[model samples]
Target: MPSDIHHPAAAFNRTSFEACVVPYLDAAYNLARWLARDDTDAQDVVQESMLRAFRYFHSFHGDDARVWLLAIVRNTFYSLRSKAAADAKHETFDDEAHTLIDEAPSPEARALISVDIQALQAALENLPHPLREVIVLRELEECSYKEIANITGQKIGTVMSRLARARERLKAELSSSSTEARRHDVR
Candidate 1:
């Protein structure tokens, strides 16, 4: 263990948690929720993460608690994922905005997108967790490479590589879904 791990402040202190950590609670909850995808599971993971963070607060320093806490949330989420394996298969989504194939889409196409955000959410929910997280964090959350690496415990290089791959996979998925929609219309 590092020297910080041995300090009294590293052990347990409610005031420390309140001062250094309370501000980040929501961010922790959000990251955990995104990774876990169920209200109960997300809450469970956040609680576990906060407890562990309290125990290890000495190891935390500087002004990076938010990213550091998110890393914990990510790890806790993965542990729960392995143990439970009965939750939503999480997926990462991209931030590329799709313009209306035409703003003045024909009634038929309007009917298609009338399915709207719900259909998009369902499609996002269907993606694998790795792809989903990368897409959500990178595109939706608009996190920088350093921030992502800090939260994910991945090397910045790995983040970039995985981010590129995640975008490619999401592109493939949307392309296929669009094809299917077109096929349905032709029938």
Candidate 2:
């Protein structure tokens, strides 16, 4: 047996690790997929993150396993991102000017609007990384602001702020895409 096996406070048992951490494998991989923007790279990130998590499992305090694992995933992603090609540059999105009002379209207007999944996916891909992350965590993962903050190591207020900006940007991008498609159809 390992020398540290007898520590009662350490939640490092393999059984506990499987119970708490294994269930969230999809969530971890989904997050990595979005951040890495490539299936192969995302797989690599999740594998590395799971290894890191297991190696440090002794330190886990038995909090929300999803959040803890995601934080590890986030760190691993940035580490990988940093080591990627120098062509990757930090980008700032000016969302303030691009903000569009959120209004429900009438049935008639809705009928005229056409948005394909590919365009929506492209718009999501176009969002800046920070905004994309918050959107993915909150909207896709259904995480609360507090959970998102814990996962991202941001304050609750910052998470709220980012979510709002991300939504606004996404809406604007989708609306513009719809309009462009309409014009092309008319031609």
Clashes of each: 6, 0
lDDT of 1 by residue, 32-139 (tens): 766766666778999999989887877787667777787888888898778865655544443233313446877777767754443555556666677667666777
Q: List residue ranges in candidate 1 displaced over 4 A.
A: 1-13, 85-114, 175-187
The lDDT per prediction is 0.72, 0.80
Q: How far is each candidate from the true structure, as Cα RMSD in Å? A: 7.5, 8.1
Task: Give the poorly placed runs of model 2, Cα more than 4 Å off.
Answer: 1-12, 88-115, 181-187
1-187 in candidate 2: lDDT tens per residue?
5646567644447668889898999999988877877777788999999989987887899889999998899889999889988886433333332233335966444434424455566777788889888898998788889999999999999999999998988899888888877775632
CA shift at 29, candidate 2, in angstroms?
Answer: 0.6
User: What number of backbone clashes does candidate 1 have, counting pairs of residues 3 or more apart or in separate chains?
Assistant: 6
Clashing pairs in 2: none
